[model samples]
Target: MSLLDFDADQLAAFAAEVRQDYDVLKDKDLKLDLTRGKPAAEQLDLADALLELPGKGNHHAADGTDVRNYGNLAGLADVRGIWAELLGVELEQIYAGDSSSLNIMFDLVSWAYAFGTNDSERPWKDEETVKWICPVPGYDRHFTITEKFGFEMISVPMLEDGPDLNAIQELVKDPQVKGMWVVPVFSNPTGVTTSEEIARGLAEMETAAPDFRIVWDNAYAVHTLTDEFPPVHDVLGFAEAAGNPNRFWYLTSTSKITHAGAGVSFFASSVDNLDWYKSVASVRGIGPNKVNQLAHARYFGDADGVREVMRKHADILAPKFTKVLEILEERLGQYEVARWTEPKGGYFISLDVIDGTASRVVELAKEAGIALTGAGSSFPLKQDPNNRNIRLAPSLPPVAEVTAAMDGVATCVLLAAVEKLGA
Candidate 1:
């Protein structure tokens, strides 16, 4: 029988049994973390080339600019060219920004609030209350950024294809709705891809605020586990075709691909947006770390080189992801109390338990020494009204440990679901 229709009482009993087993199996009082979606030590080994600078002997860019000296506010042309190839945009349209994409995102918000985009008339901060559409079961960090800036975040529903376009169209009609955050490829925690139809709809959408943009953070663009990965629809091209050239602010980084804290990030947009961003970024700093950009350019010479690197990551990650899925199937699949996403190429597996039981399940897991991303973190303002979504990051731990942790999580889920039903 499917987990959705299993007997709650039977599931409860199994949970108790599993908890007993876990208690006995684990002897040491070791503190293990599965809260953050960080790369494991083995995964970090894949970026060893980045440790040494590529052109220490030679320091000039293709445009005759010194790589060591910092003056290219828009970043080195070759680095931008490489990132553009990876992001599927024109070379002139890409901006090789600093190490953090988050910083770039922050700057975009600042610019929109203060000066507004070229297409829009009024600044967002001048409005009574600015708002943003945050698809539910999304990246927590995205929501955090919006919340920090005091934007009223409206939670839009997310499906396998992407954010509900019907809701998005309706929300954008309100002048307060400025933007939406999307992780189109193997989205965080859910590991689902947005459909082409939704991509087209978003590109073609009409908003009361002309400055309405989609913050497309493709952090896992190249991190796929399977051979048949979903292709990212060319949203920028679609938007331009639909006469909405300024509708997207695409951001990506080699953080997960290389080093988390020290990787170069890229921003892609229309020529208009690029010019606006460059003018604003000039005031912020001279330029991002060219040495790091050179390192990335050397490591992944082109789009094909990045793909080759991702294949290595898949080798390490695929087995771990499969192990977690298998353990979850063996333990909770029989119970029918929850359902989960079987992602082909992302760092997360999203599990949905019976409504209102997520917090209890997470609490139980914590008591048993297994930590998880908070229950409501997937939603805006840390509020999941149904309290049903749970993000499982299985990549950080070793295979054996991941298996054990998943088993522990299953026990907690079953226990919580059964108790909720009993009450």
Candidate 2:
């Protein structure tokens, strides 16, 4: 039963009880953090062998290219082949880069702003207005990138399958809407994988902008909580079949698979798009870190090697995620004042509190020394219209810490809801 269904006196009594719990939480002096979806220490340990990988004086790739020297702007074939198999792209379509896929994403947008895309009639910087479609409760860093470039961000709700395609289809009718960002599989916070129907819609949809692009950031492509890996859609191929070969910019990284800071990044796209990217990228630098690519290539001898590593990551992470979800249900299930995702994969659980109490809940949690991702963090511009959503990250903390943090968080949510109800 919902706390809303309780009588005035019942509500008041519940409020008092929750207040007591909150006070006790504060008194416990807990210093727990549930902020970022970073891999835990244990998860990192699984890839420790990479620290001494490719051994000393072993500097050649399978093709006998000297990895010690620069100029494989495309990266090692073995490395690209491994990721190509994993990401469902052809070997020729993928470009393995340095550690950060975010860097590659930023460069794509920046390059478009400066030089336009392969299909662009003019540079985005020269446009009268550059608008972007951002799925709400989406990735903050993605929004930050567009925000920095001064693109007008249009928000659309994220559905169980993916971003609201109806809304997106309408938004793209204007030529100013240059692009959109999508995580595709096990999206951030919500863990809503884009179904094939939605993926096809995104691929087949018509847009007024000749250079409209989709930055498909598959950051968690292989980060599954289950034994089975999620399907990797052939989005680039979908676009090609839809006669929009240049519509998608596919990206993925081994950041979570290996070392977050030192893993390899990948970019795959149409031949024209790749040509366009290389034209400018070559001017910027001689090549990516081929030696590090060699290390990662040597570390994961094949695609299955990457999957085995992820399975180990799953073993470490699944328990922490389970604990958080269980605690959320045990503590807040009866009240019906909140809802959260039970993600099978990905690093976050999207929690929606009472219509306007999310900020209050976060504040109460902070006062009790439990740090959470800020309120409305999952939305564009850090603004959730209802002030209701919170992203809970359980991947970084240990299971016990996740339990404590989530329990404390539940108390905060109850307290905030009761106070908002005038109890």
Candidate 3:
């Protein structure tokens, strides 16, 4: 029955029962975390070969450049080629760096503020009011980078097709709205890939700022958990066709694919944007970690090898995600007190509970020794206006632990609902 069907006395009795159940949970001393999309140990084990990789005497890059030496700032040529086949970009458009693409993102925004991008009339910091669009229930880290730059963040709804492009187009009509952060494929915390239609629209849309950019973080491009994974299509072609070749700068990494801190990062863009980025990046160093990139190229061999490893990851992750979903359904389905996204390919399942109860649910989970992503993390500045959305990261824990964590979480959801309804 729906939670609304219960009368005051029933709710009170049910709430009391839930309280007792929670007390039992607290005493159990469980220490489980469902807080981040970190890979499990065994998952990390899949890339163990990278440790001794390029093995002895295989230190030369594909083009015969000594990878151990400085220079080749664009990174190993073959490494870029591997990602080129996957991202559908020409190799010249791609630049590989060290492990964290998040670093690349921060650098881009930071440099753009000081030196400005190719089309900018002046540095972003010079603007009277710098603004950016953030898709709600989106990646918190993405929001943090832009927010740290002091940009006025405008939150728009992130639908299954992607961020509300209509809202984004309208927002960019203001010259101060300098850019947007996007995860075009298998977006963070939602797993919804932006449709080709949306991608095309973004490429063609009019903006008041000539330097407006789309910082596309396709982090989950190969992190598919199922077969329905959609490739992010021809964004560059569409942008060029729309006469806005400078509109998007794409960032990606193999952090989740291989060792989290040891994989290579990539940034792809138009020639002009890339040239500008290189000019600003030249002072940082002569090159990135080519040793890591060389290790990756030797490990994967090609695009096909990358996909094979991802399939192994799916074998490990698919079950944990399934267990979490099964528990959520079995516990909360009958009550109709919640709804959630069953993602085909990303690291998270976005859950929504009855209004005003999300923070209470998270608090209850914590008291029972289970940790979850904070309730409002999906929104810009961690504020969920409706207090409903919850991002469940089922990727880190083992399958059995995921089952336990979700059970605790479901109970907390019920307890919070009962308290709020007062029956």
Candidate 4:
């Protein structure tokens, strides 16, 4: 019977039983983590060949620019061409940067703050109150970046397909709202992909800020857990058609596609946006690691090579994600105390415990020696109004460890719900 179906005395009895199980779990002293979605060691090993690449005395780029020395501020034309194909853009529009895509993103936004984009009349900092719209249950780091820059963060609901467009259309009325953050495909936690309608709507929507931008973070463009290769909507193309050619700043990385730490990051925009980005980038540093960029070029000869690499990652990751789903269903399916996303691709499973019990569930799991992402981490400022969301990352650990941690997690969920009902 359901906990809600029980009378006061019965609820009390169930709570006592759950408490006993909790005590037993505590005695076991288990230690496991399901925090961030870090690529597993096996996934990183796929790009190990890049280490010995660009063989000695062969540092000449396809354009004849020696990568060992500094120059090509926009990156080697050959590497840019490879990245342009991956990003679905013209070669001149994309700029390959250092290992971290987040670094490139940070620099872009920082430049917007300091100097603004081509569309803006003045720097973003000139505004009395700059803000950004963020889809909730998003990547926490995105919110942190905007928040750190003193941009007021506004949360918009994330729906089955993507963000609620109605909310975004309304939020952009404020000229102070400079832009929004989007994961585009295989989004973090929920794994929500921007549909054609949603993508088109976002690109064409009118905004008060002429400089309003779409931080199009296509972090998982090619990451598919299933066999189907979903097509990416050409946001840049759509925006250009909408007469908003300079409205988007596209970003991507080889972080998950190749080596996590050593991967090259990329950004693509319009001709004007290109001038803005490269101009700012030139002042910040000389150039990205063209040597590593060259190594990546050789490793992934073309877009097809990237697809093959992701296939290998899916082969290693799909089973672990499946195992997590299986454990969640077996242990908690009957109770209905919790529900979780069965993501098709991307790095995490977004789980929602009974309202008011999420934080307690994580607390109980911690005492049992399992560390889950803090409850509400999926929301902006790490605040979930109902305290119901928890993100589970199965990629970092082996399948067996994922199983063990999830089992304990389910137990904690049930116990927390029962205790709450009894109280």
Candidate 5:
């Protein structure tokens, strides 16, 4: 039965029982973390062959450019082409860079702030106030970037299909709303894939800001948990068809695919947008890390190679996800105090606890030596209006650890919910 069905005495009894369970959890002196979605050591080991890749004299790219020396700002065609095919964009439309798609995103925002985008009448810094649309229970890092730049982040509810289009369309009517962030496929935490209908709506929406760019961060486009991978949507094409050819800025990286800190990043958009970015990028540095890009190229010979490696990752990851879901269901099912997304892809599972108890749940978990992503982290400025929503990252921990951590977490959830009820 739902916890709501419990009377005061019954709820207090249950709370006492849950507190005993929590005491036992703390007694175990366990130190388990579910903070960030880092690849497990075993998952990293799958790409160990990359260490000796592009060995010695194999320094030249297929285009006859020496990767050892500087200046292929566009990166190696072999690697670029591989991602191009995988991302469903043309090779020339995409450019590869050293790891960290976040860095590329930062530069784009920074550059726009300093020099303005191709369509910007003036640099963003000149604006009276720059606002950004953020999908709630979205990626924290994405919000961090805009927050750091002092942009007023407006939160929109993330529906099952995607970010609320009706809300976004209304928000963008303001000229100061410069851009928005989107993890198009298997979005962080929520795992809500942007339906093609939503994708087209975003691309075609009439934003007052002529240069209203959408940061299409497809971080988990290929990181599937099932046998079937989600399709890479033609977002740029959607923009082009809508007469806004440069409406979206596409980005992806092999950080999770290969070595997290030593993989290649990619950017794709209109030819004009690509050239404009390079114009700014050219002044910043000589080129990207071609040697490392070539090494990645050698590691994943082509697009299929990436899929094969991801499959190996799925093999290791699927069970951990299943375990987490099983624990959440088994422990919290009867009470109905919580509900979590059973994601098909992506690195996180979003959990919604009883309103006003998420922070308490996280606190209880921490006191019991379990680390979870901070409560309200999925919202703008670290504020969840309802004080619910927790992002659970199961990718970093082993299956056994995931089980223990989740069980302990469930106890905290129940305890917090009961405490909120009885108080």
Candidate 6:
């Protein structure tokens, strides 16, 4: 019988039984972790060619600039050309940078607080307070960056299409709202793509803060599980045509496409915005690691090479995701005590447990020898108001282990729901 269909007394009894079973299970002490979203060792091995890239001797860029020496603060032109094709942007509009796209984001935020973007004259720090709109069931790392800088984060509810446009529109009317972080394609945890209509709407929104920008971090742009996944509409172009030339700042990386620590990252925006960014970034460093850029240029010969490599990733990730989905369906589908996303692409499946029970279920799973990303991690400041969301990363585990882990997770959900319902 489904846990949701149970009467109060039946649920209570079930909870008691689960508690007793958990105690016994804990004694065996098996160890398994499904916490971080790191790629498996096998996945990392797929990019072995990148290790010997740029060959043993060639270390100069297409423009005759020595990669080992420092000069081009924006990055090598050939590297920018590579990302231009990948990001569907013009070569002049793309900037290839260091390993961390997160570093570029931090710089943008710092600039907004210190010097301001093209449209606004005053620095954000000049104000008494600054606010940012964060779509809930979002990426924890995204929220961490904003919160660390002391921005008042307002939670915007997420729907299957994307973040609620009504909420975002309403919130942006406040001058205090400076920016919003978006993962438009295969969003973190939820795996929902932002709709074209909402993307356009976001670009056209009438904002009180003239310097407001959309932090478009498309981290999983090429990481799809299926061949039929939808195309990502270009928000940068949409915004420009809608009369806001500098409305969006898009960032992406080859972290999953190649080596995580060694991959190159890309940033794209309008020409005006690029000029402003270069003026500030020039003071930061001489330039990004050119040798790494040269290596990626060699490894990905052209745009098509990137597509060929991504297809390989899909082959490996598809089975793991399928196994987790099947296990969840077999064990928990009938319960109605939880609902989960059936994503076509992306790194995670977001599961919503009964209200007030997500944390308890995660705790229960841990006792039975499983580790999960802490409950509430999908929300700002790690707070899910309803306490019902849990992000499950199934990509790192092998198919057999993914099956076993989902089975354990389903049991914990039912047991926790029963306890919360006082059955």
- Residue lDDT tens for model 2, 259-324: 898989999999889999999999999998888898898888999998988888999999998998
Give the per-residue Cα lDDT of candidate 2 at 143: 94
What is every candidate's alpha-carbon RMSD to the true fold?
Answer: 2.1, 0.7, 1.0, 1.5, 0.8, 1.7
- Reference-based TM-score of each model: 0.94, 0.99, 0.98, 0.97, 0.99, 0.96
**Number of backbone-clashing residue pairs for each candidate, in the order shown:** 1, 0, 1, 0, 0, 2
Error of 2 at 374 (Å): 0.8
Better of 3 and 6 by TM-score: 3
How many clashes would you count in candidate 3? 1
Ranking by TM-score: 2, 5, 3, 4, 6, 1
Predict model 3's lDDT versus the native.
Answer: 0.90
Q: Give me the runs in candidate 2 sitting further than 4 Å from their true place.
A: none
Off by over 4 Å in 4: none
Better of 3 and 5 by TM-score: 5
Once all C-alphas are superposed, what RMSD does model 4 give against the true structure? 1.5
Residue pairs of candidate 6 with colliding backbone atoms? 11-423, 12-423
lDDT of 6 by residue, 1-423 (tens): 788678778777778877676666566575777887778778888889878878777987888888998778778898789778767788888888988898889899989789887777688888888999999899999999899889999999888999899999999999989899998888989999999999999998889888899999989887878765457677878888888889899998888888887888888999999899999998877789989998988888887777777778889998988888887788678877888888888899899989999999899989889999999998999999999999999878887788777877877887787777765
Would you list the C-alpha lDDT of every candidate in the order shown? 0.83, 0.92, 0.90, 0.87, 0.93, 0.86
| lDDT of the structure predicted as candidate 6 | 0.86
Candidate 5 residue-wise lDDT at 145: 96
Clashes of 4: 0
Model 5 residue 298 CA deviation (Å) reads 1.4
What tens-digit string does per-residue lDDT give for candidate 1 at 136-162? 899999999889889999988888788
